[model samples]
Target: MGADDKTQNNAEKLGGKVQEGLGKATGNKDMEAEGQKDQSKADLKNAGENIKDAFKGK
Candidate 1:
């Protein structure tokens, strides 16, 4: 993956983690679910980037 893409994905994952933690602490199920969804999306994007890089032999 490109450096920018990696950084963005990491940031997204971190944000999601923070959101999830806050939701759990405050007993907000919706926030927790949203956080989980965000994390999942970031993960999927990361995976796609990895696959692309592998195919390109980078």
Candidate 2:
């Protein structure tokens, strides 16, 4: 993946982790779920980028 995309994904994943931790500490199930969703989205985007890069032989 490009540098910007990778950076954005990493930032999103980190943010999600923080959110998840905060939610768990505060006992907020909805916030925890949202964090999990954010992480999943970041992971999926990374995976897609990897696939594209592979196809391009990069």
Predicted structure with the largest TM-score when compared to the true one: 1
Q: Which residues of candidate 2, in runs, are more than 4 Å off?
A: none
lDDT of 1 by residue, 12-44 (tens): 999999999999999999999999988999999
CA error at residue 40 for candidate 1, angstroms: 0.3
lDDT (tens digit, per residue) of candidate 2 on 1-58:
3768978998899899999999999999999999999999999988988888889888
Q: How far in Å is the alpha carbon of 56 misplaced in model 2?
A: 1.4
Give the least accurate 10-residue stretch of model 2, judged by summed lDDT: 1-10
> Model 1 Cα displacement at 9 (Å)?
0.6
For every model shown, the clashing-pair count is 0, 0
For candidate 1, which ten residues in a row score worst on lDDT? Answer: 1-10
Candidate 1 runs further than 4 Å off: none
